[model samples]
Target chain A: MNDPIKDFVEQHREDFDHLEAPQFNLAGFKASLAQEPMVKKHRILNIKPASWMAAAAVLLVCTIGLWFFNSTQQTKKTEQHLALNKQNKHPKIAEKPLVKAVTQNAKQTQFAAHETTSHVKKHQSKEEVPFIPSPDQMLYTKLNDSASSSTRLAAVLAIKKSELISYDMLDRLAATIQHDGNSNVRLAALSVLEKYRQDAHVTNLLVNALNHQNDPMLQLSLVNLLGKMQNVKIDERLYALVNDPSTLEAVKDEVYQILLKENKF
Target chain B: MKLQLILLFALFTTGLSASAQKQYKLAKNNGKLNLNISGVTVEGYDGNEIIFSLPKNEDEEVDERAKGLKAFNSSGFKDNSGLGFDVTVRGDDINVNPVSVANQPKLSIKLPRNVRVSFANNSNMYQDTVTLKNLKTEIDVAVTGNDIVLTNNVGPMNIKTLHGSVDASFPADLKGPISIISVNGHVDIALPASVKANLEVISNYGKIYAADDLKIAINPASNPKTNATGQPVKTLTIGKGVQALTIKSLAANSENQDENAPVFGYEGGNYAESLNGKINGGGVDFILKSNHNNIYIREKK
Candidate 1:
């Protein structure tokens, strides 16, 4: 069987050797390669390495500048706060941050600012430079900031001596009468406000203060103040005081006396 | 040699005993002491340091088992002074606070005569009376339900008490801007008859009494016309050319009116009355206010 296969291959060897291979076609192969999809080549930006380093440096500088500017603004604000506190003769309040101090007294500050702006506008016909806080304004800040009762009392006394007491000052004094922790300070403020008792706003403030005050002395003083005015508006408040169980008997007696004088009892 | 050794031992023991007293050196001038503790006696002496000591309690037996261990409390303070007080000094201010509320030992504090003292009793449970003696400087005290007694003090004092009495006696030359206020308690103040000061005594739901020795010239309540300046102007001329005292009785309707009047008029009422006057010649302000109690102005003997 191996001899037969060898004879066949020997007979076919001449034919296989005579058979030629197909012709090669370079242009056709190239055309077929062109028909296939082209792959994208990654190209870098046409920027220099030094330029990139410069851009990074500029970014770093901008970041540092922004930080420095913010810090400087904060420092300036702190210095301004310190200067204002010093003007009030309270050196201790300078220790706290300006944001904390303002936010803590946001309501009082807003009232004072509004009052001061209106007061300034009323006094000045022409537009002036940025408003500088008056000495009274500085003292108003101290009235709320000073922790010592004696200092607050002194501040009130100083305001009492002011030649021209503005409505804003009266408003602040009224607020002190309502909220000051020390009764002595509240009493002093009440005495000062009594000078302007004829003003409707001052009377309204006194009536409102009567509701918040629990001290017997303050309550009696308020009752007497309102009774002297003979304003029928405070009768309801006085009646409420008489009906409330927490009202001191002394205050109720004063209210009754006032009502009796008015013939409303 | 034996005798020498015995002498050395005696000397060493003496030194140890002397060093056992707890003391803190304070500034010689303008020093301040702040004590936020109760159940203590504060006495002023001629010393440059704040010396404190705890009284021995015979009833409390020693615990032998806890001898080696350090004591700690929930307040996170150790017994550093062995006097149940943690005293910290910042600049010229000395702050003393109790380490623990439980088992508070009786403390005696000796302060310099010239140093200012501020005492506060914050504990509601321990409302023991505090006595301050021989203080020659500013005294500021605020307490709750604790009676205060000040003796031999020449003060610019501001004292406030709630549900407690105030008894203060000043020297002949009393330096004052003295204000004493009490709520639901009596206020008794004794000043020398010759002292020069403007005094205001206010009592709500109580009465005001003054001694006969005090030459108090009562001024009539000012009318609206008299107070034209819108300020309270009180003028008095007792015997000579001296300012007058204004006695305001808001409780004229009360039922208890004393018929036998001593030196000043006594009208009884639950309402508040304010008496403003000057003694000798007006110099400093001395105000005494009491709510729900009587006010006694006595001439110091």
Candidate 2:
């Protein structure tokens, strides 16, 4: 039953094969592929615009911080130089370690290269040493000339912080204690006086202040200072304060305490 | 010698019982009054002239015959200064330095308001009360006998008492520094709600208290380590203003004091364990110091 159909199909197969078997356009396909450009694949690790902006901002902040730090250092150096100049002006003081340290920290070699040579040249016509004035000297000057209590207080604080104070400065502090209207300033002056307690001149000034000061706080402070001295001639003042009816009760009590400690009661 | 003693006794008796009354007007532009009295109650009010009454006893006197008082105006150079004018009452100038009147007739003085006044009482003037009401100027007071109460006064104040208490109420904001120091006495300060200043308070042997609404920074020093005496020091800033208020409790020994060496450090210390703090972020330096006394700073209700 399949012989005639099979023979006919086998005869048509060759005829179909002979007909154009769906010709493929290989050249056109290649040309189309060539027309579309290839796109590169995106990578995972890429720098973004925000990253650049952030980097720039950080750089700006660091640069500003460096500038501020340098400026502060420079200011400190200038202050040190001024102090050195003041110390140098006083021929009595031969050594100023603070001046040495500051100058060294500022790279004195560079400073000399940039400044001392030129300074010598410019000031050679005159006898000027071209010294920098110190902040403490300025403060001391203010303390002497300024009548304001707040100014006096600030100056005293600055002087207290100064590395070296002259005997003149000590005398000024004693004067402030005796004359300043503000008790706070007087109290600070007392502290400054405590530093020079061993000095006989300071002791004399304190005694003078005791006689003139009506402020009980000052009186008490003076009494305490006098009491701390050993083998000193403060008994007369103590006895006077104890006997004086005008003496504040607190002061009398303190004086009594001192007397009792000294076994003079 | 016996005859001289009898004469002295007679003079003393006359001094004790002298009774009189007087009045005086203030000089032009002379608004400042200073009172230095013993056993006298000085009251201030709004008036044009000052009146004085010296009662025979400390108690209130109803009988006019039991009192002696006088008032007068005098002008002269004081301690080589330019001509300074003051009203004098009962041999005590309210304008000059205080003079002691022992065994004398008790005095009552009334002063006009808005006058710059300074009152100072000695230890003999026990329980003397100086009350200044409704004033507009600086008030400086120092009392050794008892208590002083300043109500409704404004401007700068410098007050100190040896063995007495200080009770001050400021109705308005103070324009300048206010310093108060007391030894063996309590201090109570009442500030208006609108008060703004930097405050420093220290108490060597007492407790410090502040109102709840009042912002205070206790021991607000940038450095917490105290000086020698280890007494607590405090700062108070009230309302972020330029003025300061400082209170301190002094101790017999506060702040480390080197006996034989120069001090080269930040050398501030309190005498007592002070109640230190800040109020309103700090301003002008107002300082209060006390020894063996409690300090109370509060906002007036």
Candidate 3:
């Protein structure tokens, strides 16, 4: 209440209060405001955070679509490649045209079976000797060279499937079982010979394998083979191994078990 | 101490130049000998003690002669428990320690029949062969880049090799398990005709040949499991035959996953061809495995 401004205001109160009021023209002021450069109406649609989000969503959808399309194409390509590889690996067996030809030939042969029966028999006798194609024969020849073990195995399997394996082939399999550096190739040879167990030559090879093979795994197999023959001579040999003090206990136990089962005790 | 150090240093620097032939008669009484000789073949001969033959490098110009046994003792060979030769009253455990020596010389070791031998020979660029006859205990042998020829050994044999073939003959009296593994080579084992044991043989990128005369109980109709290469699994019994083996092949039903399907962005490829069977009604388990090679089991008549 005692402020200096208050005293000054009291002194000039009448002069300040007696000031005249001027009439204002509302319409003219509005006209002048309008004449002044108004904020030029924003002509361009301003980009917003929402607009950016929508653009990103569109880009994401396109990327996903492209990736899905590429993956599907890649899968198709891989499948085709694998099918081609299978065909290449087994050209003789996998050639679809050859299979179809075989079927067609069989169908055609049914019409004149009696007319060609004797001729067919004569051809069949000769066919049995070298029934496989020349390429397979070449493959069998490669089996003897110091080729890769895998290559040798492939050849053996192919030969087994191509024909009634000749005695010569069985001999080769026996030699492989005895001395092949690759056990897998040897095993494959053994499997191929499995169908020829009744052959005297194969039985002799089995007996030879039993006598000379040194690998325990191979020996086990030979023993198993010899046992199936149920030969009295083989049983006696097995019993002798069981009794031999110099023999391995694990091996002796095996022999003991076999002898017990065969009632050879 | 300084003088001793100097003498040792001088001895090490001039080590290869010394062409000395030495023999160690360790444990005149029945004891063990642990020995490791690289770039040399150790032909094990039966004896009552350890005899080491260190041949003299007579060639004067060849300064890279192998030094005689690094640490020797009349009682036994000195070794760290883990890697070196451990010769104790109990037995011998010999391990391969990569010791670089100039022109490494061969060492012939003769030991008593009572000794248990653990021999590992890993020589680079040399094909060393090991022949052990008349062994009485378990044998653990590993040879790399070389071949193993074992004969008339009685014990549990665990043999492994890389880039080499394994040929082992087990006596009929041999007991315990025999596990043989080879990479890039063949495994040939000869067993007595009456041997009975559980068998698991696997060969990747190769074939399995079992003797044709052996009756393997394989039913392809019942066995649905084909190998990675689609070879049907042949499961059968040799001796008394054990419980039926469950052979796994390719999938037989809808739930069975495609083996060739891409897994984790990689192609699912199975290359192993395996045979699971038993011999003599299937007793103890014996495993023979080879990668990129063949496997053969022969009967020891």
Top-lDDT structure, candidate number: 1
> Who wins the TM-score comparison?
1
Residue range A1-265, candidate 2, lDDT tens digits? 6799889889889776776767899999998787665322233335687988999999999999999998799667554332211222244434664554565554645554556666677657644334454565577776765333445655775676454555556777888887776665676678666655555566777777777777777888677666766556778778888898888777898889889987999
> Each candidate's lDDT (Cα)?
0.68, 0.59, 0.55
Cα error of candidate 1 at position A231, Å:
4.9
Q: What is the DockQ of each candidate?
A: 0.03, 0.02, 0.01
lDDT of 1 by residue, B1-301 (tens): 9999999999999887666554544445456878887766788898877778754555767889977665666766665666667777778787877777766766777888877888888566877777888888877787867899999888767777767899988887776567788867899988888888776676655777877567664433332211222343233212211112222221222233242111232122224566666677576667688767888888899
Span of 10 residues, lowest total lDDT, candidate 2 chain B? B77-86
Q: How much of the true contact map at the interface does candidate 1 reproduce, as a fraction?
A: 0.00
Model 3 ranges off by over 4 Å: A1-265, B1-23, B28-35, B39-46, B54-100, B213-270
Please tell me which predicted candidate would have the highest DockQ against the true structure: 1
Candidate 3 residue A30 Cα shift, in angstroms, is: 99
What are the per-residue Cα lDDT tens digits for candidate 1 across A37-129? 442222344456899999999999999999999868755644433211111123443344454445435544665676777769877776544
B54-99 per-residue lDDT for model 3 (tens digits): 5554554532453443543454445422123333443333333323
Candidate 2, which segments miss by more than 4 Å at Cα?
Answer: A1-170, A179-216, A224-249, A256-265, B1-23, B27-31, B39-115, B123-127, B219-271
